[model samples]
Target: MSLQDKNIAMLYYGEQPHPAHTGFADAIGADFICCNPRSDGSKIDSPLNEFFNGFSLPDYDIYITEGSRPLYSGIAATIFSDSNLIYLGGDHRLRELSLGGFPNQAQTDTRYLRTRSKILQFLCQHFIDGAIAVSADSATFLQQLFGSPSTVRTAKPYVQRDVFKSLSTLSTDLESKKVAVIASANRGNVGDYKGIDMLVDSWPDVRNHFPDLKLEIVGKGHQAKHENTEGVRVKGYVEDLDTVFESIGLYVQPSRLEVFGVSVIESMVAGVPPLVTETTGASSELKGIEPALVVDPNPESIASGIVQYFDRTVAERENIAKECREYAMSFSPDVRTKIFHEEFKSLIDEIQ
Candidate 1:
């Protein structure tokens, strides 16, 4: 179908410089629009605002909705107004909203019933066909909120090709003192869920094991305190992550829970070994890959995993790196886009 004839409009917070969000928009053949609140002097209001102000979608069948918090509010309103199907992607935070003062069974029932009534009203008004959530956890949350499990479908998170290409050139030299990277964010922020504090608390033990090991910390908010440690460096908010990935020997993601560990996949594609938590979404995909080390969030496990990599022979390390890179290629954006296209088409047909 032609872009106009397809009748799809993707409502997201805004296009990040990161490839995944923009890449998904390109793949869907939909009119992508930002619903984020415009901040004074912020560049976020530049091109997207200009485009959305003048743009209109005449014939889109779906609205691929993404983003967190207030942006979600705007997208929800749009969905209600349009009577269209919405595919919820990214982190699903709606399940966390509190239904205040609903203590008694009667009050609780009334609260939930009211919420569902509004949702159903919106769905009927907008002609919502269905919704596909990126994670099973997210789908479960939606089902709980809506009291209709049939309305929500679950899908695994996919990697974008551009991110793969960016990661593809990363060096896999284990002998080098290339530190694994973690970007800290504000508490209760998106990155907070990434478990930066877990890594921070483990830093001292990690440093004691490998004195020469360096940590490349990026992004803003509470910087990790490595006061007595020499190797830990905070490189705040780097724009060129490709360069950072190139110099890094490994990427570490110590999250307690993750819907999809895109960073791990990116690290594998970059030929950098990933030391990740077993609880992460990427762990399932990295099963049998030698370079991708799955470890507990504890400092001892993280240190041991690093030591094992260092202890390996150059040839063995290279072999592991090759395996990682090969594994990462299977999740490339093009492959994922095709899968999404086919799955979405099938869902549409099934509903029709």
Candidate 2:
């Protein structure tokens, strides 16, 4: 049988998972399983492949788990002890990314707690058959952590580009807020790291030039607590942002640290220019697409990045909007699906 015929399963966190993930698996014809308790398995057989809340791994040829550390991830490892298991990490060293890519420099958490978690996470990490890295930075970190580079391969979980591409052609109120950021609130300490506070604080600087420009912040639980600043508006979780992205002039994801930024790719597909942090995997891809301004997550840097879009004419915006859609197509799920299948095929060939 061809390597494509091999049965594979994936375990990942999240109750309401991104459809793109299951899209990747569906494209490969692999069964899907969720590690989250709240997920009610798969309701429909179409659109989403077989997603199960239970971890009864059963007879699968290969089981790939994304990011190790969650209790569910540990259960997955224990469930499929002797199978061809590949641990794919977009950012296994995610904690180390805060505070200008130096977690040790931060004073928020106890060193003992961080150290203990790191050691424990590493111990759980070391036992996997292989590590599938999704970014160059992640590959580098994985090599140093394991002292072996050969076991790692790159297979990015790219954005569902076509979804946003469909929306790019749709109509939105041109007079609406032109700049935006979407990240879930109630993330505790991580919310600040996502640049929520910095984005909020940077409004005054951004509003100085264009008095009418409003920075829209969309996500759950934050707008309730945050007051509407001079030129910043916070909205609770938005189920549908279809029309919203149509009019957005710029999409800024100035996250202090992000292993990957799907919103960047999605925004680009929506024909909006992206201003992402230099520290993220998405920023690296954005560099290839177009020099969509890379900035630090600091208030000054983010403010400056937002201001650059203010000077563009309608004609220039329209032209760049076309370019953004075309550029985003390169990172489509169809492209990544082929790469995903190859990564699995190659790994299975090596071991079996």
Candidate 3:
């Protein structure tokens, strides 16, 4: 059952493969393919399988899918029919798991369909042979959901450390006063779970402490109203995070709910300190890292964290920034791939 030379497949949404799953694929070597079921018969590059949905599935030794059934629907039954299947509920979908009676939440949210949740709940509860956790917190949650907390594997989020590190440079004085937040629109919208609104609400207080403070929100669909707000700028949908991280001194991750925060790690490697919340799974690894700030997701606490950076003199800030760069070196892509590869190998070894 060792993953060496074993065929592995991962199911995901969208035309391109997701970065998170890419890490898993890299761990398993080139034999692992990213399966995109919704392709329109168009040509896709290698390592991405577009025809696996309706056609005969390749004889994969291992198969993995996200916790949601949205991608494959009834096709899941076919994929799970033979291979060693694993469910990954690591997207921090507590509400979805709650609906499934995972015991993480006492009651399901009325906003979601109880009948659908019940059906999927039964599938997750009984079908998958194993599970992969993105973090320790995710492992615990999966244990409850999979009914096998003692057996799930834990791996932290992956960081493209070298790319970001190469883009990182010492910022000029003006750039030092700038702060940035990088998250998808769905995740970082003002009032949504990402706490973008909490950061925006706290901006006035941050400005009160340091009037020259400038904050930039980089992601899709940032509201036009917020564009006019003083000392705040919104840039929608930047394809590359390297450009955003290059000039900013700090990255803020104030999410109300998150299994893992990749951008935070990306920023860290780009020579920026991150202000995160314990609510994020990445916090377990980021809590004590140099110059890292952890606080509640509320506006007051987030504002306080923002102000703390200003509290330090320029020289002190520069010193910590150097330390942060060094800290970022530990989580490079190769290191992460090696760690997960061994973890996956261990899992395969344990399997009968």
Report the backbone clash tally of model 3. 2
**Ranked candidates, highest lDDT first:** 3, 2, 1
Q: Give the total clashing residue pairs for model 1.
A: 9
In model 3, which regions exceed 4 Å deviation?
30-56, 66-75, 78-80, 94-122, 168-175, 185-191, 239-243, 290-292
Q: Give lDDT for model 3.
A: 0.66
Across 1-352, the per-residue lDDT of candidate 1 in tens digits comes to 3333566666765444235655556666766655443434354444445334323333345666664422333334444354355545465344323222211113456668577556644643344455665555555555654456666665555566555676676555656676665554444333545666666566667667667777766566544464335666667666666776777766788765565667777777877778876655566656677533888755566667776766677677777778888877867777776666655655555555
lDDT of 2 at 125: 54
The 0-to-1 C-alpha lDDT of every candidate, in the order given, reads 0.59, 0.64, 0.66
Name the TM-score of candidate 2: 0.77
Top lDDT hit: 3
In model 1, the worst 10-residue window by lDDT is 96-105
Cα lDDT tens digits for candidate 3, 40-90: 555434322333452455566666665443234314434446556665555
Ranking by TM-score: 3, 2, 1
Reference-based TM-score of each model: 0.70, 0.77, 0.79
Most accurate candidate by TM-score:
3
For model 2, the superposed segments whose C-alpha errors exceed 4 Å read: 14-16, 34-59, 69-81, 90-125, 171-177, 185-190, 289-292, 312-319
